[model samples]
Target: MTQDNVPVLTIDGPSGSGKGTITRLVAQRLGWHYLDSGALYRAVGIAAGWADLDLSDASALVRCTFDTDIDFQEDHGGEPRIIVNGLDATDELRTETAGAAASAIAAIPEVRAALRDRQRAYRRPPGLVADGRDMGTVIFPDAAYKVFLTASAEERAERRYKQLSEKGVSVTLPGLLREILARDARDANRAVAPLRPADDAVRIDTTGLPIDAVVARVLALMPAR
Candidate 1:
């Protein structure tokens, strides 16, 4: 059950599907808290890597996850910064390498169970907007609004490549497309909490939609406060 009258909007979709960007914008518009659950997993993955722990070792990963200090802080501009173990890991966590590690660790049932409660703690008064593979299906099952934002592999990859290029990161479109497809398969076929739209979720195909247009669509779907 929810802690109080606080409402929640869960946005779930495969990586590179634009759910992350949409969730943040919706949260800002509603003046609600935002939970980037994938960042938590990515932080754990980074920690595990630093500790020289094998990703296949569930127990080790769980230990590393709990031992790591992960927090999301907002800068003066209100941009979220991911901090892990007192180090700014925002950029590192966003890398495709960290994303792959997160996907692997996320498949571990124990890891998911360990982070479940931590994810729920973000639900404060007013509301919250959460984005992740299982936000709608698992984490925020009772959310007032559930959105599954998706796009074609080609489109998603193109968007990701463009973003990385703007950041001056050297990457190839074909490589990004391959990784997106592989990650999508892994997320959708995982044994526990596989990625899928909640039955009541609103599906939005954002293949060619502009950012503002998509944002407007989601805001329109929100219930009046």
Candidate 2:
């Protein structure tokens, strides 16, 4: 797409900070395509695990990124289905094991480079809502609107616990809290594209705010449709 045709809104923050949920809602409201950048990393990690490739092997991971054909499909019901190499991996990608593995592999610079073009291709004519750790800062630095949504670590952990329990993935609240904090540290301190709010991004603290309230705040800050 040409420069004028590329319009995007990026929402970036630490994992379990409600960025994904909020970005999906915003995309639905605006009738735009949604890009869940984390899923790319998760799919790669799952593929590597299945192939018996070592997670620390950067070369193998980069090769897998190019070899994999990942698809994100949404039916009329508005539920996303992730397919990797013709295998439906929606459930597999959500497991805690997959999440941790994704975080580990995402820290590799070569893996990020391999997926950069794939992420950029999501920005099409209508628009896109991109969500990830470095969407605003690194992926779509020229995006029209950027938001960094965050909450207290405890609050985020509670939210994640409830979400996982609803999905039938058993998780302890304490363990989830620790994982969130650790993931935050790793994402922030990583040498390549560390997680942080872009200079022009609007930051929102959702610690005690309702989902609708946060959405409303975001809409108010966004450029008119």
Residue pairs in candidate 1 whose N, alpha carbon or C atoms collide under 3 angstroms: none
lDDT of 1 by residue, 1-225 (tens): 457567888989988789889989888899989999999999999999988899999999999888989988989987889999999999989899999999999999999999999999999977899999899899889888998999999999999999989988899999999999999999999999999999999999999999888899999998776
Off by over 4 Å in 1: 1-4
Candidate 2: regions farther than 4 A off: 1-4
Q: Cα lDDT of model 1 overall?
A: 0.92
State candidate 2's TM-score.
0.96
Q: How well does candidate 1 score on lDDT at residue 203? A: 96
How many steric clashes between backbone atoms does each model show? 0, 0
Q: Estimate every model's Cα lDDT from 0 to 1.
A: 0.92, 0.90
Indicate the worst ten consecutive residues by lDDT in candidate 1. 1-10
